[model samples]
Target: MSDKTESVSTLENAMQLMIQTFHKYSGDEGDKYTLSRAELKVMLTTELGNYLGNAQDKNAVDKVMADLDANGDGEVDFTEFIILVGALTVACNDFFLEYNEKGEKKK
Candidate 1:
């Protein structure tokens, strides 16, 4: 995370984007600090539809919410959201490495 006084690097900008994205969908009908199930559904479908691949499916959303709601409070907090993003980032990195390895082997 970048301190307010420091210049924003690319990583810092990405952090800021994550924060912005969270708040963008967090406070509609429920707590301003967390995401309700409905809010989560909209956020997932609208922001990560491609990456999540079936976010429109009700059962998928329920499963995701259950997995992410660490406290079982029926909502997802920022920490849980960050964990999801981090896992996805790791998965994408693995995919990229595999793709590059395949390309190298073909050369």
Candidate 2:
């Protein structure tokens, strides 16, 4: 298989693993495996620790939550959570790939 294909497969596997793990912990109620935009934002912010500081502006997070919550529900379901997680995974993977490429170039 081509390098690009291999990369895609790897990402797919990683996403599946994440979803499985989430489901294992979250249970099957109301799509608990998926995370809403608000949930994801909160997670990321918490992970960032002191980097984000005390950013009170919830505009971005609100917008994402609103967009992802397609059913007009107050909370996110499993499908929406999966979509958001996929987007985040792609972004993070791309960022790391770029960083790795740059490092390789520097060597």
Candidate 1 stretches with Cα past 4 Å from truth are 1-6
lDDT of 2 by residue, 7-38 (tens): 55786887777666555534434446555444
* lDDT tens per residue, model 1, 1-107: 43668677999889999999999999887899899999999999998998999999999999999999999999899999999999989999999999999999999
Q: How high a TM-score does candidate 1 get?
A: 0.92
* TM-score of candidate 2 to 2 decimals: 0.52
Q: Rate the local accuracy (lDDT) of all candidates.
A: 0.94, 0.63
For model 2, the stretches where C-alpha displacement exceeds 4 angstroms are 1-56
Best by TM-score: 1
Judging by lDDT against the true structure, name the best candidate: 1
